[model samples]
Target: IKPPSTESVAVLQQVPIKPLTKPLTYPSLVSVVEFISFGRRKQLYAKCPTIRKLEERLPYHLERVEIETIGPGYIILKFDNFSVGPIGAYRNEISMWCPGKRVTRSTNLSLYEATEKFALYNLSRPGTTIKTLETKYTPKCILNCIPLTIENYVVDGNDRDKWIIRTTRPVKTLQTDFIIRHDTIKYAKEVTVTRPSHLPIRIHTDILSEWNCESITIERELTHVEVVDYCRKVSKRTDRPIRSVFKSGLGGYSTELFQMLSRELNAKKMELEGFFGNLIQCATIYINESTELSVLMMEPEIWIEVSTTPPSTVLQPIKPLTKPLTYPSLVSVVEFISFGRRKQLYAKCPTIRKLEERLPYHLERVEIRTRGSDYIILKFDNFSIGNFGSNNESNGKIAMWCSGKRVERSTGQSLHEATEKFALYNLSRPVTTIKALKTNRVLANETLIFLDTPKCILNCIPLTIENLIVTDFIIHTDILSEWNCGCITIEEELSYMEVVDYCRRVSKRDRPNRSVLKSGLSGYSTVLFKILSRELNARKIRMTVFGGNVLEFANIPINETTELDVLMIKPGVLKIKVCARRTAIDRAF
Candidate 1:
């Protein structure tokens, strides 16, 4: 029972093998086939897998077999049957399988071999053959007979390929010549063959022999040359004659004259001394020459030698002295004289004169003698006397000498007065002094006589004083005694008065005061004050009269109509008050 059960189990596991699955065949061919062949022989190669499989299935009686795998992943099956035809000739047949299927359908392949000869037909129709030719060949016998000849020819051949046929040529072209010849061969033909991939293969052919040419000459012609005689003729024909005409005083010679004048002027300019005055002289002469030339061709040469002379010695005219002559009296008296017409009269009796009659009064004779260039001696005699004493009772000895201007004195009242008055007066006028050397008494109202240094007198009074004295004495005669004294104190007072009066007169006469409105209140009030302060600090303006407020004297108007922003005690501190209608800006004057 166990054996019969085991057999049944084995039968159940076998299940009859499923009928072999349709003979285990591959799919039908779905891609085209291609083949390549060597010409004139049965050397066909299958370039596609479908064609290769088909050829592999063929009987071994057809040809020699080879299998090649091409670079693009295609298989080739080559069969050679050399006895069938020429070295290279074949037809290609292509076969392909249907889409979405394996390569199992078998058909002829269409293929091409690079070495196969192809027909080039005319462009008009498919059946028209333009030409038919075999691929070029050299017979083995010919090649063997002249091995060295062929080799030498090929080594020096014009064609760079060095083919076996080139070895038979008689004359070989050099490489450089070959290049040049090729460039000049315009009849050369080039063709391009494109594959289904659109890649092109270029072919070039030299058809010189077929085009009726035995040989080609690659030499260039000389197109341009310069012959010596031709060049000489050209140069001579282009050459110009330079003719210069010299005319003597002719009309057409203007340009020549102008050129000549220009050269001469330039030469003269080069020789010039470069002083502006000299240049001006040359320019003037040039203009003059140009003007003359413009008028006529031949103008007379006017040569003006303009050499400069050294500047002449200039004598400054002497300025006549304008100061008045002053003399000192022996008895505290003063006198003055003009220096012009009365010069000779002063040598006789130096005295003052009345302003009206211009005559001397209170006569007292005195003689003056010059001791040196600047020293003098005076002699007084019988001088009339008044307040101090009689002239006969006083000593007659008096002398005088000149010195610098009197700047100071010792008498209290007179010195103070003179200093104060002269301080102002000295701003404009200067004084001169003469020292007395002898004692002389001069009355208050008598003519004062000045004596020589040895002996002289005036009313027997001594004329020696520290300050200058004025006298009431008048000049009644044309003598040295025309001066007389007033009071001594009055004299001092008069000196102060003279200085003050001179200052006042000069201040009034030289610079008069204009109205504030005329000068513009803004200028004197604001601008002038600032300028004055700056000038005072710089010592340009001095404080001369110090007793009064200058602002009050300036006479600026002030009224209730004016407004005052602030009353400034000093520069920074101010008293601020608002006025209804009295601000300073409202003021008109």
Candidate 2:
């Protein structure tokens, strides 16, 4: 755009080809990201203007993060389907790999102190949740980087130092693999440990049997002699009720633990409602007015859990999927990416795009819809992606959601383009066999017209579908003729006579179980009905526009060609239902 002058018409200086980029604003980027890959995370962390107050705004949950230093000077951040590094080998280089792409580039702060600084930034977020944080070595930076208290902590593998996890919030459940020095279990409300490891760590009986938590699970191989010994110690320790389980030592029945408790503590066997173990075979050991210990045995695994309350109340730590815990191959990884980033990867990353294209997508039902003309959403199976925002604004923010949390990012593509681009790259790649397909103007519980619905959906709507429900969607003639769906319900396309021709054409080979047209048969009803009657040859019914029929609702069989139903829903609305075997008489209540 250029300023115009009356004297001499000012010529346009330049026409920008693309939308302007969004400025790097820290406040706008405050989203809780579910997945951040090795390379991308570092870049985002490095964007932090200062190192302090890192937890004040960024409230992310790095569900599964693995920090590895496999080779000398080689560090890696593995999350989702990608890897960030082996970065530290070169002072200025960063390497990343996914299914279709692997890139190695020279940069300013990737391999050296810059990487360390980014790692520091990650550990500084207080109250943030790291569902499963696994590290080969607990570096000084991670231990010292805790500016504020974290909600939960998980300790895995061998550790040189027993760093106490100081959390201000309650630790729901803590599962430790031989954490000897740090009183980590004390802070947890419930604890599940493997009875410690073999040597010196196993020797600390107090640490091993610390019942500070409300409930505890101590699993190990148990013998008859060891069981008797443990019972005596439990009698001496606390009489609240100690429930222990070992394989199937009794050969059968859940009464083994109940029988033992009754004999040792002189505990009474009472039929308590909703007690643990198997109540049919398991009897509750009622010692006091309120306390009792219940046991359940499930095959090779043991059923020993000591608790003041029933063991089922204890919250178990949510373990990250074992497949995702390790560095995953592209096919194995669940595209754990953000909305904006996923679109970028599909478009720019040839490797990933090709792999996705080669694979077959299992689609049960697909729904592509538009909200007025501004927003659009494509839903398939349980997964859905939504796009919204104006593409023309200079620095407009585009918000979208793919799988995890909703992400809002600035984009050059408008909502229509973004929705279509995502659908094209994602849907077009796979051999989509849809069980059912719907193109609608309205979605979610609201009604809307598909004024801007894309062609990609209609072109590939599979034949396996039971119904092809199109409401207020602009339809193409070729697609209309090609459909052999069991039920064909359309509105927007029914206005054109060409669509009626298409209907007549498709009805020749395979008459849809039923069909409904909202409009276009008004003036040409005689000709169109005559055409349909001749094409289908099911039974003839005269369709006289919306309201000329004698009966309000008629199963009119005109000329003995087509069976049709004229429904006068309201003053301005009319409907024509074409049913094959059943007429209005047979369908009437």
For this target, which candidate reaches the highest lDDT against the unseen true structure? 2
The TM-score values for the models, in the order shown, are 0.11, 0.35
Task: Estimate, for each residue in 283-324, the C-alpha lDDT of model 1 and write its tens digit.
Answer: 111222112111122111112221222234223368886865
* Candidate 1 RMSD computed on C-alpha atoms after optimal superposition onto the true structure: 50.4
Clash count of each predicted structure:
59, 12
Supply the global lDDT for candidate 2.
0.49
Write model 2 residue lDDT over 48-165, tens digit each, in one string: 6452244335545555666675544556765545666744345577766666767677767647444455567655665556655555544445566664343445555544344445
Q: What's every prediction's RMSD, in angstroms?
A: 50.4, 34.3
Candidate 1: Cα lDDT at 141: 23
